[model samples]
Target: MHVDVKELKGHPGAQRTLSRTVEAPSGLGTVLVGIAEHSDLDLDLRVESVHEGVLLTGTASAEVTGQCGRCLDPIGYPLTVDVMQLYTWTPEANQTDGDDEETREVTAELTLELEPVLRDLLVSALPFQPVCRADCPGLCSQCGFRMEDDPGHAHEQLDPRWAALASLADTLNHDDEDDDASS
Candidate 1:
């Protein structure tokens, strides 16, 4: 979504309420991280002229699909999130002593693009490690089987001394699962 900054840029204290459906740019599928690209998003926002710049506050939503991070099963879901952002005029609106790249500015055309903002928030809101359910057993490392499909999935108990080599594989799998969870 792009808002005309002229509507509020110089008109300090001005306000406008907008409700629009905006298409996420093509190839947004890559930006989704784990979810499917959303062709469009529903946005309900209030643009207010603030001393600093244009303050946009509201909510955005989209339907998305992803796979459970563990079992790799298809997961269809909807994502809804609240977003608040300030788009400022360059240089003059650069109130911070921070890096120039850190400031979000309005375009020379006096337009504020909201695509990046929505994409960032939506991607971050999605589960880093999504699951079909909280208690999903995921897949068995031994036979590449869906554990939930067969909750009793397991290998036969082997002799302890000889089992060390076999159990070592499970240990490695546990470590991998841990690493994935941390990320």
Candidate 2:
């Protein structure tokens, strides 16, 4: 996503609207969800010429698709992130005495690369734990059963100390029943 600012460099306040659809880039999301590569990405932005360099401000939107972190169900949604950045006219001008943030720089070739900037904004806006829905019941930890299918599903767990005795008692009862049937 490179924009040429050749004409806007010398004149401040000369702005132009940048509205177009481009292919989505890779790594634009977390492990659970993200925008697919080569997918449609809509950029609606304003590129203005400033005295220092160029100001890029607008929104970038795309469809995010992935599996839910909890239930592992397929999930998708549209995500739009705000973009605001200023590229200084020269690399040397980006250095400031007390500013810790790295300044954006317009290239010597009179072009601005928007990919890195958009990646930062979009990735930060993505949820760390993506969920299919707020009320998703997820899966049963013990059996991996879908909890939403049966909300009251459960397992009868026996105490480890009494498990052997319980099995013995069941075997004895079964033997007695077998003897009675034989008689």
Q: Candidate 2, residue 10: CA error in Å? A: 1.3
Residues 60-176 of candidate 1 have per-residue lDDT tens digits of: 888776677778887777788898887777666676636454446888888888878877877778776777789888888888898878888798857788888878899999999
* Error at 109, model 2, angstroms: 1.5
| Whole-model lDDT values for every prediction | 0.76, 0.90
* Per-residue C-alpha lDDT of model 2 across residues 33-148, encoded as one tens digit per residue: 99999999999999999877899999999999999888999999999999889899987778652577666999878899999998998889888988899989899888999998
Cα-based RMSD of the predictions, in order?
A: 12.8, 3.8
Q: lDDT score, residue 48, model 2?
A: 95
Which pairs of residues collide in candidate 1?
none
